[model samples]
Target: MLVTTPHQDHSATDLPRTGPATEPAAELALLRGDFEVHLTVGAEAADALAAWAEEHGVKFVHILLARGSAASQPMLTLRASGSYTEVLAETRRTARRLAADGFTVLRAKVESVPWAEGVPASDADAARFGAARYFEHHVKLLVPEGAATDGLAELAVRHAAHLSRNARRVRPDGVREQFVTQRCRLVGSETAAARLDALLADLTAAGHQVASAEREFVALDSDETLDAGWIDEVAAVAKVAAVSTAA
Candidate 1:
């Protein structure tokens, strides 16, 4: 996906591939389209009447029926899709209908449906979940008020480049499917946060923020998030490549 470079000053031209290596023509095809809409809608019956009331987004909705008429099962799950702007407009319209019908609704939950999982609006969408859930995060890094503020520009440059490597796009929660990852090459959020903290140790209380809420479409079998262990994969590949070269 083509992302707007967050800042003009950062140039990360040699960023590594997140997706597989592709022919130039294949890459062009990937870029020549708008991202179709993908997000999940969650709402529940406030009472028996609302529970059975014809659900909004029903065509796209995943009905999580309350165990019995008055019972609570898990929660509502509706997956909506279409052109980006139109899907959102339609979802908001559906949400309004649900609220009016008396269902308790959480804000729409955004999900990243990767290729292995299948495309949005598939007949099998109801049966699929992604390899892992993704987060659309906003990070705040400021110069320490009392510390040397001279490095803020440099740090900002690095941060912007880092974000580009990890995410599909740099956009807001509702406009959908945005992702955030650290550029420091450190994987854990806590460790990454500490690195930012130590670097900014003074002045504007420089640190990071996890300002987004994440949701998954289905029960994830693993807790994997960051690429903390990527080195092993790279090392294993390099070892075989080296052997092949020598042979």
Candidate 2:
């Protein structure tokens, strides 16, 4: 993946400067590409949906189902592949089964399909395929604000501490087959560079190689060959990375 440098300051007319720009930038990134599935359920419905998805080979990146306002009511939000036609077919199958079993289909909506950053529809196919490999699963963890005045410095200290203690025990929550792990790395924005440097220093102290560094991201390597342990460590690193990057 091509690492992006810290953005140049925006002109006064271009964007508001009352707060941090990164928040809005992240929001826009989310808007650029996403797919959503909406469904409502009664008791035992979520289990049925999971079973149906498994039986039909319907893979998704994230599947979130929550209890609604009343007892025995549930709602699901699923994000999956970008292919609309194929996804619709899968949804239909699920709906048919649910309907036959006397469940209610509240609303089915296909939100935005994933699209290339700057590619026009005419060239979307080639652009999508070329850019698809760059997609990585990012998990963000919030840094708590304590009684310290220097939030950034405190963030660094806590991050380094977390890495030392817990950067190797986080296990994946059964999403492994749907999402693949690639070259796991640490990353930060310019605002968080000092904290990043501190964390990277801790990583090096632990004997992991600093594989690469650019303004947007940093890469780290394990002494042992990459395996499930590395995957767990990456999850731990992700927690630290997220807190550091969070404003």
Candidate 3:
């Protein structure tokens, strides 16, 4: 990704929007095996994200809430096999497709959950690769030479529990497997969002380049009641970030 230069202002298409025009989300992924993928492009891309999830069995909070953009082409059929080998191949294909789709590709990778090299020896062994949905909440920046470590450290410490799916999967009837934390992102509350925004603005004033700093509300895919859990998680996300920044 181009770090030194400021990110382009990704203009939204005529598609319905869930938030401010300045904030738009685009996503593409395959949720099978260890081939999980999640990414957000321009706000215009949310059009595709919304339509594709409903068409396929995808789980996404942003798409469910989004309303403005027009109809968009779906990227991939979500009806993929759970086999590790099959999904791995599909994930590679998915990444290639994304690269050719005009979006900038950064560190495209396919990894095994338990860190195995070759295919599993038995059906049971392969199950350890457990299916998961991939997503991340990040604030990319180009700080001073020495500041990179601190920035990365802060991200490592705080962004893990910040955002959740950027994903919307259509599950089969009556399937109720609880969605665990594959990972998380963004400030949770308006106050935290404003504070983080202020910090980024201050960084700009001090000559630091912020490539992207987005705020994501709390999200989870589960059958249980989680209203309180959501609030606590969001608050925890905000607190960790603030503490990390202060340190």
- Give the best candidate by TM-score: 2
Regions of model 3 farther than 4 Å from truth: 1-35, 61-85, 95-247
| Per-residue C-alpha lDDT of model 1 across residues 66-102, encoded as one tens digit per residue | 1223212222334544332333334345444444555
Backbone clashes, each candidate: 6, 0, 22
8: Cα error in model 2, Å: 54
Candidate maximizing lDDT = 2
Instruction: Estimate candidate 3's alpha-carbon lDDT, on a 0 to 1 scale.
Output: 0.33
Cα-based lDDT for every prediction:
0.30, 0.33, 0.33
User: Pairs clashing in candidate 1?
Assistant: 144-202, 144-203, 144-204, 145-203, 145-204, 146-203
TM-score of each: 0.25, 0.27, 0.25
| Total clashes for model 1 | 6
Model 2 is weakest, by summed lDDT over 10 consecutive residues, at 217-226
lDDT of 3 by residue, 14-56 (tens): 1113322212112112222333333333444555645644544
Candidate 2 residue lDDT tens string, 41-96: 54456566556545545531222211113223233445544334333334444544
